[model samples]
Target: MNVSEYLLKRLKEWGLHRVYGYPGDGIGGIDLALQKAVDRGDLEYVQVRHEEMAAFMASAHAKFTGQPGLCIATSGPGAIHLLNGLYDAKMDHVGVVAIMGQQASTCIGANYQQEVDLQSLCKDLANDYVVTVSNPYQIRHAIDRAVRIARDKHVPTVVIIPNDVQIKPFKEAPNAHGFTHTGIGETTFAHVTDVAGLHEAARILNEGERVAILAGAGALNATEALLTVAETLGAGIAKALLGKAAVPDHYPFVTGSMGLLGTKPSWDMMKECDTLLMVGSAFPYSEFLPDPGKAKGVQIDIEPANMSLRYPMDVCLQGDSASVLKALLPLLKPKSNRKWRKKIENNVASWWQLLESRAMQEATPLNPQRVFWELSPRLPDNAIITADSGSVANWYARDLKFRAGMKGSLSGGLASLGAGTPYAISAKMAYPERTVIACMGDGAMQMNGINEMITISKYWKNWSNPRLIVLVLNNEDLNQVTWEERAQSGAGKTEVTQSIPDFPFAKYAELLGLRGIFVNTPDRLGAAWDEALNADRPVILEAKTDPNVPPLPPHITLAQAKAFMTSLIDEPERASTMVNSARQVLASFLPRRRD
Candidate 1:
């Protein structure tokens, strides 16, 4: 067996069934080996249009499944393209591994064509480790160590194999890394800090009347425990977007995502609470949280550095969210104050009304929010959603509600735009039995969705019931960027850089032989979604939408107001900008509760 064969064998032992990547001359040998592995029904090499998509898909796969998502790229440009997605995985704290092909070993240091010092270029991007296989015998151990580090540290890892080394014989290579291994390796990595600190945390919780819980992806597995703790403390729960699945939104005291993309009740929940408990989520937007001295904090996380840095903590507990909660529950005193919880419940209920009103409003072209309203009810209970970064993500986070079993994600920390198609494809590959949807803005769809849609067409029939849908908001603008520019500098400039031409995305999907539906009117939205949802093959639904809608921040600052006023003054088209901005803001609001 050559090094390529041994690498595949090691990956199979690591339980990787599908790897995302693009083919290239430099990595020809590895591709040949992958094709053979697929023919024998052992593994699959899902081809991608760009190397960046490979990284994004791998990152999303790791996020959805606990295992590391894998990708491969050829030398130079291909390896360089993987950096952004790799950084996305690093910032989001997901396990991802990228195997990069390098120039021939003999030509590596001679500046041979397409030769890049890949190890050094990738050193800063890799969250944990980066290694270049210098010999044939090192392949097995390198793969084993990369996989282990990815899972153990929850960070991105990279392994480079020279083109020459990939073809070397591996029959005598020692599998020393797996020498002591047993059956299937599903190692659980837990950082349990202190079991005794639960008392201190419980004491802090008991002392505060108005308590709130801020949850992130760390709380994914500890949902029941977190909810139980919330109920005991009569607390309201607000999730970081990464932790959108931490608790079901249907729970009365649970508010949706927190940050600029969050709901009003969530912002209010953070402000009104006298005490805050942060579990698993290190939400970066500390300004959106309660003032440091205003709320006494009790944070629970496996990582000690993140314990109480965001908010002042009365007690910082370091343990797994579930284990810590279980330990603390027995020592905790149950609070009966329902006032704070009731207020939170009321806000959540009203936010829905506000959301539905905006989502259902009719316009000449469709209102983009209405598309989500149409799509939400049609989603399967177990569907997995992947949203791209843009205004479409705003619609998804605000309008679309996920059920208990549903899962979804996007480029969370890095906020990369071209992730919609790649992420959706990965989700479908990971959970072929479940429905998968990629909701994206036209800018993002045009970025890489067009390329990935073709890739999906080529392999849609490979899996059992590959129920995937791509929903494009054809608004012809980088709507979120436009809104941000307006909020920052002023609105009247016309956002020259933000404007983009609309493409016939549905037609592109149809040309690739996937089912396609184009909807421009609000009346056709429900039917279009129904058609897409019922299709057996991959489908794309492109909706022509109003680009004038603004994605408003949950809380407006004085600076934002000042910028808006200045924009109106500069007024290239003051009347038009003011009217449109007002309409957008008004559409987003609901009647406030009377005190």
Candidate 2:
């Protein structure tokens, strides 16, 4: 046995069925090992153009499969290219293992070709990393530890294999036991014993007339538990964008999301609630939170550090949402509070009506709001939407209503740019039957969009099937940033100079052998969307939008306002335009009482 063979066998024992990455000279031995493993029915290698896309695919696989997904990369630039996606996986708490080939141990510090310190470079991007030594005896244990840390910590892990060591002849030892140990189950429920805190939380819930629940991504696995809890308390449920999949949109208790890009009903319900229960979410916007002095609040999270960090809490229970909810369910008395439920439902209905009315009445050349409305109906029931970080995210976050059966994914906490295309590609690969669409701004499209087209092409060539739609909102500038800049500078005074070249994004899609459509009007949007959705391969819809459009997050604090004002003093006119746009957009969402 060689080092590569031993490594491959260990991965197989750990139930790894697939690996994603691009092969290079440094990793040639490992690549051959993987190919041999595939021939032996142990693993399958998915060849991608960019190492970052491989990481992204692995992250999405882990997210969907609830296991540690694997990716491989060669030394130097190949390994470094995976940093962005690895960071995203870390931030999102996805379990993934990245294996990178390194320069031979002999030339590690000699500046040999493609020589780099992968362990040092990936330290911050991964929760745990180990550089494999030449001795094959330590391979099993190192891999076992890496897997355990990656899974238990809910973060990425990296393992570096030296080129020379991988191809070296080695013998399998008699006692080649792998790492499969689990932590003591007793420690898992330690946080549930806070009797005093639990009692206080129960008291608040019992006394409050209006209770609201805010769900986060951490509650995804415990969706049934959360729904049961919401129903027991007759509470209205509001979720962060990351929590979209946790509670289906059709759930009667759901009142949509909360924050800068939140729904009107969700925001209104939060404001009116006498008690707010935050479940597995560290929603960052303080302004959207209930007034601490007036409304009592309780937070349940697996991570203790997440509780009471964004907003003050009356009760903070550091326990898994499933475990905490299970314990709390027995203690909770069923409430028949129809008043609170009715109020939330009415607000949500009104908000939906307003949005529909606006979409129907809009007659602009390229009404983004209208385009979203048209596309929403045509989207598949199991469709997954990946929104880029910018104005497009804001639009989708604020207005794109997920149908009852649809599911979606987006970067919520550290919302990074250039994630849309890769996310969509990965989502499509993870669930072939589902329609995967990436909605991004023109600027964001230029960031990581090109590489993913190749990913789609490769997948299409192999599988003869691909269902990805890259919808580019070609506004020709960083609309969100420019709007904020202008808002601070009072509009006219702020000279927004940035402009994106009119790249043939649609033509690029055609060159990749995918359908391409360039749209500049609302009427053409529906047809374009239909054509793209019906295509066998991937498609890119480049919709030219108004560059002046701005994205305002759901909540902006007084401190943020002060900063904006300070920045605005330098460009008064631009600042005024931003303020005006914000005022108008907000006015449209705010509740109105007809006289």
Clashes of each: 0, 24
Off-target runs (Cα >4 Å) in candidate 1 are 171-191, 362-364, 491-495, 570-576, 587-595
Residue-wise C-alpha lDDT for candidate 1, range 1-595, written one tens digit per residue: 8999888988998888789999887787798899899898889788889999999999999989978999999999999999988998998888898999999999878978999999899988783789998787677778888988887678999999998899988855445763432233666656564655667777778998999899998888899999999999999999898888778778988888899988888899898888899999889888889987998788988777777777778788876788888878887788876888888898888888777776655554778888997887777888898899988888888777778888988888899999888999998888888889999888998888898888899888976886799999897778887767667877655657777886988888889888888999888889899888889899988999877665667788999988878767665545655665666667665432334
Top candidate by TM-score: 1
Q: What TM-score would each prediction reach against the true structure?
A: 0.94, 0.88
Residue 89 CA error for candidate 2 (Å)? 1.3
Q: What's the lDDT of the predicted structure labeled candidate 2?
A: 0.75
**Cα lDDT over the full model 1:** 0.84
Candidate 2 lDDT, 422-455, residue by residue in tens: 7777666667777788888888777777767877
Structure candidate 1, residue pairs in collision: none
